[model samples]
Target chain A: MSELTLKANIDRPDDFYADLLAAHEGLPKAQSDALNARLILVLANQVGDREVLKDALAAAKQAMHRDPARS
Target chain B: MTKIFETPLYPYERSADQDAAEPVRHPVVVIGAGPIGLAAAIDLARHDVPVVILDENDKVSWGSRAICFAKRPLEILDRLGCGQEMVDKGVQWNLGKVFFGDRKVYDFNLLPEEGHHRPAFINLQQYYFEEYLVNRARALEAEGKPIDLRGGSKVTAVEAKDDGVLLTVETPDGPYRIAADWVIACDGAGSPVRSMMGLDFVGRVFEDNFLIADVVMEAGFPTERWFWFDPPFNKGQSALLHKQPDNVWRIDLQLGWDIDKEKEKKPENVIPRLKAMLGEDAKFELEWVSIYTFQCRRMEKFRHGRVIFAGDAAHQVSPFGARGANSGLQDTDNLIWKLKLVMEGKAPETLLDSYDAERVHAADENILNSSRSTDFITPKSDQSRIFRDAVLDLAEHFEFARPIVNSGRLSVPATYDGSPLNGPDVAGMPDRTRPGAPAVDAPIGNGWLLSRLGDRFQLMTIDADAPDRIDVEGIEVERLELSTNDDPSGALAERYLGDAQAGIYLMRPDQHVAARWTKFNEAELRSAVNTATGALSNRVETPD
Candidate 1:
């Protein structure tokens, strides 16, 4: 029932990652953290489905506690 | 200058009922002369029901409270015969600008479309609003209407009986006992009648204070709402500015919790805050200053036997959205007509319960919206503030984030989506005029749609044939036939019919759509009329 694409879905993964980091360049930690929060909110609105958002939140939380070495 | 609040508009006078041998029983006794109570009395009296309004004070309120009047309440006032005067004297505005720090964010319009009779909102002092209502009441009384406005008469005690309510009203002379077949308590937030009945509101109490200052000044500021968030003047707080009639402006500054309210309200202390918001060189005189901390709460139920609660007596909400008086006006507008029907025995007594259900639904909506606005304005935790500030920060750059910004989701009429009294809703019709929604105003001929709909049950037909009148049991449903050609602007069909070719709409006395069908069906129309009047036995089917 979940429509969230948890797997890699971007066309250019490295370029997208580089752009995300570049957007936060020349900014302090607080400013970068605020920008991240704002980006999440803006994207959540774009992904307006509540069910998808909920699944994405759970998946994100699960990854935070997962053992990185298992990957 | 002598203000209107200083004059006794309805000073106390000994009534004939007070001197009677037995407690005189009236049809209805309203327990306050505030705007809500007065409007209720006027509405009941307009229906030929004898009504009495008892209040402790003789004049309008002392301060400029509840300054913003929304369009729905303005339309309700039109039904009560004072809308024109309010619009004439009040400052009409629809544009609002939101600010963050010293920078201006996007400005929005409350009413973007046209063809509606009333403006989106008007700014008028509560005193002037009450004075206009009082004048209407006096006019009705002069025309030999069955209405009484007794000032300085305080209702000290209330006993709700199976048949009626016994009230002890203390007047200028002495206390007297009076009884009414039904009682409407509109005595405001700290309702004495509610206390006498051992009732209490249940909800959240916000922990913040707002200082409201009404000042008289000559300024070049346009008639638009200006709201500031964390400006240089008021650091880390929100502020609102609105222009009212008579060169007077209302300013609200968010003073964080744990401040001395008395010291904050002092003119010497308040003038500096005003000078900072309005430049230091601006000249102004303080008219009124008060500190208010609000709660979002309401009674568990609005009705209990012969005693019913309306206005702030029934529910209370934070003032951020101007929902206090606006919703109260709506409460009475939804109630009085149903009370009239029940009193006349044309509708079942169960109809009163729908008032409880529908208005409690509206109250919950108002509470939810105003509470959200309060939370946004005064974020509780550090995380919430971060998110709030992020939205404001992003709003300056992106249009998507602007909608996330919640200054106050200003008051709009509540749509009773799942009200028990709602009838049927056919598919393919516009949702704006769906069942249980208030009738949208559209230009018809030279007049407006709402002006012709309220005051009684009407069967409105748009390019659909219907009988002139239909009487279900004892209630009469008159017909209002219209064609799309009548409105050259094409607003009527666009609002009432989307893709449907023709429509037949059943409207209640409150001008809410009870049911709509694509074509005329006699049995369905009859059943819908029965259901709308709370005649449970005639209900053929339940609405999904």
Candidate 2:
């Protein structure tokens, strides 16, 4: 569903990942979950691509399957 | 201190039941004699229906409440016989400018092309507007078309029966009872009748408060709508400026969620805020000052049993967009004619249901627009603020993003699309006048096309001869013919019929299109009439 051409957007992957984890630091589980949800929606609006958002949603949901082989 | 507006308080007369042996059973009784209520009574009265209008207040609105009158309402009031006077008294303008943080982002001309009777918008104090309506109502009353406008009389109780509604009014003397077949409640947003009937006047109440100040000044500001986001005077809030009659200016300052109401209303506090916006040399006297929270909410149903609601009582929108009073006036416009037809036994009661469906739809639109404007003006969330600012920033240079800069979505007449009362659309006709849209006005002869849409069903024909006359059971339908030279601009024919050569449009009493076709047969016209009046229809005629 994504309009993604499998393009890499972030140049500094480690720093981006570190900052995301840092955003969740010291927060309770519920609050941290809310922060992630808000961030995802905010970024989606920034993307302004419905197909990409839907594809990202399917991909994230698929990753939630937690198959041992895929992991 | 500025003097209060000179509005004469009418004497309250006791109900006829107080003097007579039996209570007067009227056909219709309207509650809360505000602009909408008075308009309803006047309209019904004009339709030869006797109406009793009760109100708690003895005078017009305390201040300039609903200041902007859009074009549609002016047209409706024209039929009620008071449109021209209001237009003459009001300041009419169409240009609006929007700013974002010291940058003039976008400006709009509401009526880009003009051959119409009314302007896009008019700025008149609500009190003055209501006074004009009340005077017109009185004029009709003097002409013997009965409009019992009882001021200082408040309806305290409402009891709905199988046939009609019984009302209990609290006057200076005592509470008296009267029964009417129908009741229209226009008693402001805090409707006693709605509360008494246990309806949820529900919706979102915006946390942001705006200090509304009407100041009298002889300034050089042009008659245009000016909106500012993060203006130099107000650091991070939005503000609005509109010029009204009597050299008065209406300014709205966006105050945050919490503030000391009394302190904010003080002259010392309000004056400095005005000074910051209009510069230090702007000498002005405050005429009226009040604080209001933005509320974009409405009732699910405007009609209940034998009782109905209109105006602020039925729906309330944010002050932005000027939808509140404008939509309310439209509510009455959509209602009165139907009420007349039903009361006269010309149509079935089902005809009234269209008012509920149609106005609820209109109210929903107003709420959606008002809420969006509120969000854009306030932008509670950081990301939304970022997006809004981005639109504003882009709008400064590029034309594409200009529309995203939302100051207010001004009120426009609602089209009753997909309404049960509307007949199925035919091909070749444009969507603007297709069975649900308002009839487009055009310059015909020396008058306007809309001005001729009398209070009856009409078949407007373009480039074709009209039907002789429709003598139906409960309706009077007439035909109006217009040739190519009738409209010099040709916008009317273009919008109403697309590229079609000729057509017939069946319009309802309220000037809403009920049906349209490139060609219509008598049977189809009758079917459309039946459907429009809430009567069941079985006949069908295909367009040639």
Candidate 3:
């Protein structure tokens, strides 16, 4: 069985990490980015739009940065 | 000054002339303030359309008429910011049980649930549902995005105009008139608006009348649904026990063909029927009781010029499948988007015709299913009774007969095939990938993802071969790659596409699939986009 790896591009490092933190607001910082990455990919796959995915990613990132407590 | 019939509620002291005077016209006028009407008004108002919603009732009705809300309607409510609140207030259930004549037959559960953020179904009162919607309507009104709720105002006449409609309404003060670009009748089954338009509602009246009673039991019965075929209490009829929100239960008793519907409503007659079902010693107080005749009918046309009919006004189905109010709300859901498009001039008046096509199809499907359910349980004729009994008997020994006993197919969503939006492969095709079907699971960034994206319009090829081919102006496209099996070790699939193959799938805003292609070709994809949008020659250049 092959281990499917999913990767996505993040325009900004802090934004990506921030979105990661916000998505996993209740989780430890170590798990937040990985979880955020997974969530972003899922939504992008659903919308299937590179633009909306980017917008969703940026929004998630901004939310995390606004409140580190979200992490 | 002449003595005025003013009350504390009339703080503005509004006069007959002032109330009757024509005000600035809006793009849409929605009649009725019930849950369906308010829900329709909320969505249209959110899209910035000037809307007026009128209801003859001064206040929302009480009693938990509609108890169960499906996942789809719940999701729609959530989008309007009221779903979460509804979830908080209602009891959620996904598992239900069925009984055949006092014996447990089988049970089923809503399988493979999606979305960690959303629940499958909620049991809440229609009264509370209206409360949430009305609050939203009032809040929007405060912000000047008002829903224009004219409570206690009755529409006496509605005439469609070239530009819109002219409505003659009677208010507390006096009669007044209103003109708008569109008029929607959501006033319910006995809609005056539907009558004034002279639209013929056609269908057959069932032979059986149901004595519906809502009672508070000493102890909660099974949380799941229970149906008894030919129960001893009713002798030759079937009985249904369903859970309502609060600590109550709704029971339906079949009154055979010979009983008078009006006389059956009398408490004396209703009490005996209720007592028989509750048992000789069981004690319960009835909240409300009514004798309802079943009719599976729909207006021949949902629209008369600029005036449209929605909910019960447009169609009526038996309560066997809980299709009445639920279908009405779904009607509004389908209409709101098209109305928004026409209001914005994004689509022509022809687009409004699709409302009748799609919704009438839905209504027809509901009627067919509900009628079948009624037939199976009621068994009007001797031949039908024999057939139903034979099936129920076979259901005991054969798994094949189990589905018939439970009727799962009746609950599934119906397609809008007659719809011009539907393309080839629609005929005789299974509903799995059809238009208006729920969204499916797809590979996103790193994991399996399922979502309903095309809530407003159809989306074709987000990331395709050539970025320059899409022609609809103002249409947005996204370009991206997913991992394909051909390149198992390639970064595209392993790193970005969640280990999935590269393919293009078109989505409708309601999150149903329109079409899919394994590979992208610019000319082919361009044509697909045009077909999906119904744009014909209305093409615009795309950014490379």
Candidate 4:
């Protein structure tokens, strides 16, 4: 998924995601997506809660739906 | 025996006793007395490990260098018990401003609230930073800890012996050799130690050169990073201004390859550039001016034979993002535990190679990202510059262009993949942790987020009610009640969470998550813990 989309999907503090998106600016789509995926997996695993993981997945999917490349 | 003249083993060579020196042997020999190297020495000495540090220079530099330290390094300084002193001496800036021409385009509030332990970034001169480190080392030495500072001694030859490294040093009087159990080279970019080992410093060098001037100013410039694209003074160039702690403002001018670097930085020529940008009415005294060429290079292997590399000796990133010294400090942080473990005989020497592999990966990733950032900020070719300008222009009017304009990737931590530490994600669950980003708060037990900030390996299990279900090794597990009925604020109960109750989270010493798991089905977590703790694969596992 695109970094911007992946960030929006996760339930992190708004400022956190905003800061992340800001940093991801000017990056290629593939790079953005790879970084997004890496973050999601690591965080979901770190949080160690299936519920949070589900939330992240749903959010990621919804975010993907809003963007063509990510979908 | 007394009448016979003593002869050295290398009959033609000099012995290690020309100058008046102590006969004490150090367990570790750390080359380079920079902040990171000093931090490592102080840490090892405090931990009761004999450490000897050597620096080529007689003393630290007086000028301000490496003006920024990120949260991670500050946290490390905190662990070394000097974080508060650094905070007191350094300027903490939580906001960064970006300008497109004279118009300010982007601004970020690094830490909107004050509850977090650390702000986004701290600005301090490298010299003062080293001063604090030297003081700490001296204090430790005074307290009977064997932290030796051999100033003016430069390592000229490093030969790997069966037991340890035979380090050859050039003293003012003559040459001397010491057999160190292990060696850590933190010498800056022109690392003689790294070169001696024949390690490759691989990366691309940018054509752009910076004419940096540190000046004491009476102007009321805000203490924030201000970047100007197509600045008025140099239309095709870039300018950045930041206020230092001593009321000095650092100005950087991007002079493309065509300009004569040496002549451009001369006071007479540089003064006019400063005047045109800051206005003729502004009064400021120039502290120092120098031309710097930015490049991104990382050593392919941080460890060779019996020696290891840290700091700029291992890798260097473009200064645009302030990742150079920061990354070096992180390298020391990563290597400290392994060094201690190997020295204490708790783990085998083979574990040392992981330090090289893991840190090399981190350095390479940082190098690429920083280089990409430099490319975005200062494009070389006309086409790329046009593209950059077009994006910045589109950002002004188009709602869709905001993300592109405000990309926050520069501050995002470099992520680690290809790491054997990461657990497999079979559930196809969406990942939330960005590469190199900090771990998010989650309920693993009766856990308070910010309180667990220091060096400890935390293992969280899925059986929140009964965390004893999984028998993990070499880590402390904090069981969080992921039950929806128990702690409603549990990670499962979050508005963002859908279905998660049983899993595992492995946290590193720095509180950064190292790996995660759902069940103890595979031996991955156990092995990862072993790896993190410097245990050999065949070594007896720590009892659960």
Interface RMSD over true interface Cα atoms for each candidate: 1.0, 8.5, 23.6, 11.7
lDDT, candidate 2, B278-346, per-residue tens:
889998989999998867778888999789999999999998788999999899989988888888788
Proportion of native contacts found in each model? 0.59, 0.00, 0.00, 0.00
Per-residue lDDT of model 3, residues B411-463, tens digit only: 44455664665533323333455544555434444543333343454333323
Interface DockQ per candidate = 0.61, 0.08, 0.01, 0.03
- Whole-model Cα lDDT of every candidate shown, in order: 0.91, 0.84, 0.65, 0.68
lDDT of 4 by residue, A1-71 (tens): 21223443556688887889886899997556545544544454456666666776687677565666775
Worst 10 residues of 4 chain B by lDDT: B2-11
Q: Quick one: best TM-score, which candidate?
A: 1
TM-score of 2: 0.89
Best by lDDT: 1
lDDT of each residue in B268-293, candidate 4, tens digit only: 99999999999998898888788888
Worst 10 residues of 3 chain B by lDDT: B2-11
Q: Candidate 4 docking category?
A: incorrect
DockQ winner, 3 or 4: 4
Backbone clashes in model 1, listed as residue pairs: none
